[model samples]
Target: MTGKMLRGMVITLVLAGGLAACANDPSITDTIDTRSAPDGMKTVGVCYNGNNTTRAAVSEIALKACPKGTTKLKLWDKDHMANACPLTKVNRVVFLCLH
Candidate 1:
């Protein structure tokens, strides 16, 4: 292949990879755990890429996880750890669904 062709291929591949890394708006990239806490409160485990995620987006994830019209969310826990969020570095936020 010519040098020009090779460079074009490389650029295309790079662009494709970059696009793949971008999360669709409001996309949830972490595990969604809706388990009952000891007090019977509902909880969800969610994470986001701190570099690109927004508070509203994260809130939307939690809202969608809970049963609509039945519960409100309360932040229960938060931390940063490796492998917590997919497609990006770690940042986790847990919310409790309160009745």
Candidate 2:
């Protein structure tokens, strides 16, 4: 392929990759924000990139709900009472499913 064509392809690929990354994160946040589990329910976030979950669920829950991808599901953990959920009270469980 010509040099110009190659450069164009590379630029397009880079732009696509960046957009994809952006897309993934926000979706998870949105999901978490708008989620509400049943009364006295706890949820665990399933990591999209790895097997283990994150410990930031506590901080995340504290923040105001926005979207699914905003908080990231894997970062959360199951609990009898929403212990670490940023909110003062967690009456139910809502999974922060992250991509």
Give all candidate RMSDs, comma-separated: 4.0, 11.6
Tens digit per residue, CA lDDT, model 1, 1-99: 999999999999999888766643334344344334557666676667777768888888788887666457788777666435654546777787677
Colliding residue pairs in candidate 1: none
lDDT of 1: 0.67
Error of 2 at 79 (Å): 14
Worst 10 residues of 1 by lDDT: 26-35
Candidate 1, after superposition: displacement of residue 8 in Å? 5.6
Off by over 4 Å in 1: 1-11, 23-38
Best by lDDT: 1
In order, what lDDT does every prediction score? 0.67, 0.41
TM-score per model over all chains = 0.64, 0.38
Give candidate 2 regions above 4 Å deviation.
26-62, 66-99
Candidate 2 C-alpha lDDT tens digits along 1-99: 999999999999999988655433311212254346556434443222111223354335423353444444433333323333322222333363343
